[model samples]
Target chain A: MLRSQFHIELNNMHVELDKMCHLVIEAIDRCVEAFQNHDLELAQEIIRNDKAINDVERSVESKCLSLILKQQPVASDLRDVSTALKVVTDLERIGDQSADIAELILEMDEKDSYLMIEHIPSMARVAIEMVTSALSAFHEHDIQKANEVKKHDREMDQLFEEVKLELVQIVKENKDHVDLAIQFLMIAKYFERIGDHVVNICEWVEFNQTGKVNDTRLI
Target chain B: MENKIVAKNVNLHYGSKHALKNVSLDIKENAITAFIGPSGCGKSTFLKTLNRMNDYVENCKIEGTILLDGEDVYDEKVDTTVLRKKVGMVFQQPNPFPMSIYDNIAYGPRIHGIKNKRELDRIVEESLKAAALYDEVSDRLHTSALGLSGGQQQRLCIARALAVQPDVILLDEPTSALDPISTLKIEELLLDLKDKYTIAIVTHNMQQASRIADYTAFFLVGEMIEYGQTKDIFSIPKDKRTEDYITGRFG
Candidate 1:
């Protein structure tokens, strides 16, 4: 309680980061839904809202810089500020990947019939769950939850491979299906990259909690 | 590195007030070890003990073994003058003597019976250069020490301490009274000095400790609370009390 003003500013920064996490999570959710139902309007909305996540990232980054310059936090306070700075990068990238998926969904031909591919949606669901859990782990400071998110990434990778093989089979069955299959493949890859971003976020959560990244102490 | 100074089960009392608990730590050879805590935490009291500066305090009682180079410093037969020469000290303020700068640097050597003028001049020049103050004041060596700026005076005090070529240097808030640039110069000088002398500092500035110390010890209420590598202590301190203090959450 000694540095109450510093604590207040640090808490405000945490709140801003939390808000950014929520925005990124929503983008992932809405983009997946838009991809599944072929809702062009919702896809456009998610793409537009990606800017909000970027703005929050910039705001949180500025707060962290100010806290470091003015308060000169050390120990866990230092770790928290550094982790926030790194986490926002991953969160912003997650938002970008989600927006990229929405863009790919918008590029789908109206008569493509690729929406029948079940594995792509499954990958999207898993990616969304991993992202939610990773950010939650950061907010809650739960290393166990962060580790679980890391483990879940393997499942995401497997789903991506399945989607790739399924699309390849559809293209082999009919050369005319190549265009739609390739678009679906690109969407699955975006989800896969989102999974990687979630893993990075989880790593940063571990760093905030334990001051280590991938079992190596950074300080 | 080897243990240049080892203090074991050290306790001190000024009359009925226990100023230091059973403190024990090793000052590594040729490395900067910083002691940090809030005011009146006995960090300076403990620093004074290293050079037996507390012997002058009335009603002071000390119980411990302080070893310097494997020899007990408190042993009755140990010459206090020689022991003091081996463990020189600097105070919080820039306490330069009211004499010329050349005499201030030459005072300790003169006391130790070095009367040769050429030898004294060499010692003065080497000490000033070692303290990183030679270039600015070499031409004004005979000028009064008090006329120097606050930062320059502090470094001159450091030069005075270095004139005798002590094996270890103990500083208590050496830069608290100076400007930021002066503080940084002293810090840089300490970093450079560690190659030839073991250094222990007592400071209230946690950032200063983190910046220059190879090792850091946190003291609290006459007790040594925690000690470790500076990186580990500042990043992931094992004790919550230490974490609270370093993070400015301690009341």
Candidate 2:
């Protein structure tokens, strides 16, 4: 079981993956916080940190390539390395969507208070939890927990549809607040996409655990 | 594709050492099939069984059926010389006979009863051309085959096989002894040759098999572990042992 240098290198790669997860998690949290408070400075900060996530993504990729070439990993070990390659892309996309949500927040002119903004926070919370749980499932090699993360994405999707219906109601109820409702819908759409990325991460978790990228589990 | 040869439940033992275990496979016509595995895993032993090359070994006993064109090759009435002519083998080393280049290519034809000089010259030219060595060695037909480089000698060996007009060519690690450029040229030549003749190659190199073979059989510990399309074997092997071996995890 102790494969000397290869074992050590794979463990190190796992630690690097945790760091990538941390960066993505932070981006999601910051984007949600800035959107909730309508804080322009914090939104700009979320935009800036996407660069850090991109850097980690590239590093993880090259490290994976090195491990494959040097260690020639196979079977479960190969699946681990290959899934790491795939997971980083989904994680990187999560960071970009968070930044895009932040950018949209910057456009939604000052709304001191909004009626339909209630669901946005829960959608953000669900998206972040799905990502966190999916990463934990990957780290633990838990197929059941990964499947649970996929199930949580459906909740996020339902919340997305609910927000869309509410926005429609608001557009019909008051023409004055139509612009604000549309922005909320865009933010909800971004969160739903981020949740889909989380589902993709869970599917890749299945790939790492079983060496099968289950297409049926795909968003 | 039609099968050029079929091996059914073949087993071999060398003085109580079981070298092959129930090995059966169909070699498709005009396509290259590669046998890949670790050393002493019986890939070479099975390749020999195809042509009865194991008959000379002391204490070697074989149990199996090998059919070439639906004719039982192991039957007492079958002639090994005729079988070998149909199944020409190239070894791990560049083994050109100690003779002129023309003579080396002409050796098989002469053995098959071609005595005319003009006829021999034409076979020599055409065989060398078919082996992709004609341009380099055409002018040196009378020169010593031993005088050529290692790569040239191997190609001459191939040209020698081609002269026999064999239906199936067996290559045993043919490029293991050559340089990279020579290896690539031989690979290219084999690709061209497959359009006319069925070829079975035994190589330790997985990439070489993946690069050239249409079907690959993975052997291990004297057993045929997995056999399938080349892409499937390399990408998603059904057997754990095959996956482990191809991924360089198994010793």
Native contact fraction per model: 0.97, 0.11
Q: List pairs with backbone clashes in candidate 1.
A: none
Tell me the tens digit of each residue's lDDT in model 2 across B105-217. Answer: 98999989999999999999999999999999878889999999999999999999999899999999999988999999999999999999999999987778988999999
Each prediction's Cα lDDT score?
0.92, 0.88
Best candidate (score: DockQ): 1
Q: List the residue pairs that clash in candidate 2.
A: none
Model 2, runs deviating above 4 Å: A1-11, A33-49, A67-82, A103-115, A136-158, A168-179, A202-219
Q: What is the lDDT of residue B227 in candidate 2?
A: 92
Model 1 lDDT tens row, A55-166: 9999999999999999999999999999999999999999999899889878886565535677876898899899988888888999999999999889999999899889
Best by TM-score: 1
Query: C-alpha displacement of B37 in model 2, angstroms?
Result: 1.7
Tens digits of per-residue lDDT for model 2 on A1-219? 335677778878888888999999899988878877888999999899999989989988988999988866655667778889999999999999999988988887765343346676789889878888888898888989999999998899999988888788877888997777777888889899998888888888877655567744221
Model 2: what TM-score for its first chain? 0.90
